[model samples]
Target: MSGPSPAPAASDGITPLQQMVASCSGAILTSLFVTPLDVVKIRLQAQENPFPKGKSFVYCNGLMDHICVCENGNTKAWYKAPSHFNGTMDAFVKIVRHEGIKALWSGLPPTLVMAVPATVIYFTCYDQLCAVLRVRMGDWAQEAPLLAGAIARVGSSTMISPLELIRTKLQSQKQSYRELTDCIRAAVQSEGWLSLWRGLGPTLLRDVPFSAMYWYNYEKSKSWLCERYNTKEPTLAVAFISGAVSGSIASTVTLPFDVVKTRRQLELGELQAKNLSYQVSSSTFSVMSRIVAQGGFGGLFAGFLPRLIRVVPACAVMISTYEFGKAFFRKHNQERLRGPLQTRNT
Candidate 1:
């Protein structure tokens, strides 16, 4: 036998209502986790200073930096663990209090639209890549899985990058995008069609390794959970715990890339400049070299702590919620189909 599943795994019999609530909570959680870093990354890309003074809504994460205490030995930025830890709850408060329920769904459309097809592509391509790897290396332990995940993620990221780019711009605004079409038009008219993928380099930079770890760790943990604990086969709690774990691991591997991509996309002239650099790769290298020379590596990972804080829990919540909601909806529909037949027979 495989094993017994856990105590809370039974779920007290999950209801559609609870699942739906959990899902909405989850999405908001991820967005909260990601946005502050999103702001910082974008600003960095735009070539602006990561931390500007004031309570501006655009990037209000001055908490990531240090207060410059008079320590004799040296200066090291302390991780504001408490502040970072509270990001999800804070997001919940902001949404419920300020904008109400509608705000919870703010990034939903784009997320749904972007994530689904990309997932399809990633899985399909990953399976194929793994099949090839199986032939070539027979599940060779070290770097093979990482390479496969990276390759698969690259294709998905390319397709999804445009919508993702628009979503970022849309969410950051006090007024969200008038519509997806309008967002597309505005991005193109101003920045050219290519601008939709402004931060693509960084995205792939983060995704490849992240995807590998996500799948590898998730599969291992889930199998273990199912085997060792009384995990509910299909319940919000399990998904939540699994997703949170997944997000946390993914965040660490992909954070640096997220930082770079944010900076690339945020910078206004970067898209056109990058396009121009295609004709001159050497020139592009020189420009990046100059930026590093000026700012040092810290410029690259600016606001990472805030981002890590925001994203890890948010990811856990959102993904878990989404999956559980989907399961609940499917179950509800099946029950509805059976109810009429039972009533008619009775």
Candidate 2:
């Protein structure tokens, strides 16, 4: 009766290499899709000084060399009447009309470079850690996803923190650095090597908790949906819905930390651009307190709308594509293994 439960039928989960491949594909696609949203989000969050209506100001939120004008109640870029952005749509239109469509992808190069390795490490580590923790925890395995996700994020974020700093700086000012190496060299020369890791504290504060919540909720939601739908495995739709729900919840809760991180990064970029030696505050709490003091509690939540919009679909598309790729590899591996067995039997 039980010949050992038929030896559990050999699991067909994809290998780590497959996972990395899937994750890389997902990261590239997600970056291309969401860069516009990211650009707009950064612009909104980095704006500290308000450009009053009908006033021209040198607006630099990663894309320098633009005179922001408020004309007809709309913020226009580059030598138009000066005004504040009405909202996200206004910003989008102005950026396109004045800066060109490519402006929306201002940080694409660094983003793509960061995304590939970051996502590969992140997803692969999460998957591996989850498997290990599940087995180790035994009966409490249900909590593995949260822990694994948090740990994975910590590792990946730390590894890619420097790239993230560069990406943020590049996004905040246009053509500030002649090249990537020039940016790194300037920061190192001005602030020492540690400067490259600036804003990492706020980054971890935002990312680790978000990762924990996102994976926990995603797993729970996917499980519930699967049960309701009577499916043994998650479909693309299930993954997408789960990702959107989890991402939105996580992004909202972590929005404050994100705002702080953006501010810190932008300040650093400005300092480096000016070649100024004045160091900005590096403490996460200090930054948060300053934001609160300057703009009330609501200030901590700048760019919430664009962030949510970006994260929801970014999570949805990225996770679904990643899961689909994993599934495809799993099936392929199973067939490949089975072919030899069937041939031997025959």
Query: Pick by TM-score: which candidate is best?
Result: 2
Residue 92 accuracy (lDDT) in model 2: 85
Every model: Cα RMSD to truth: 10.9, 6.8
Instruction: Tell how far residue 159 is off in model 1, in angstroms.
Output: 1.6
Quantify how close model 1 is to the true structure by its C-alpha RMSD in Å: 10.9
Quick one: best lDDT, which candidate? 2
The true-versus-predicted C-alpha distance at residue 43 of model 1, in Å, is 14
Encode model 2's per-residue lDDT on 165-207: one tens digit a residue: 6655554345555676786887699989998876567778988
* lDDT agreement with native, every candidate: 0.50, 0.71
Clashes of each: 18, 13
Candidate 1: worst 10 consecutive residues by lDDT? Answer: 62-71
- TM-score of each candidate structure, all chains considered together: 0.50, 0.76
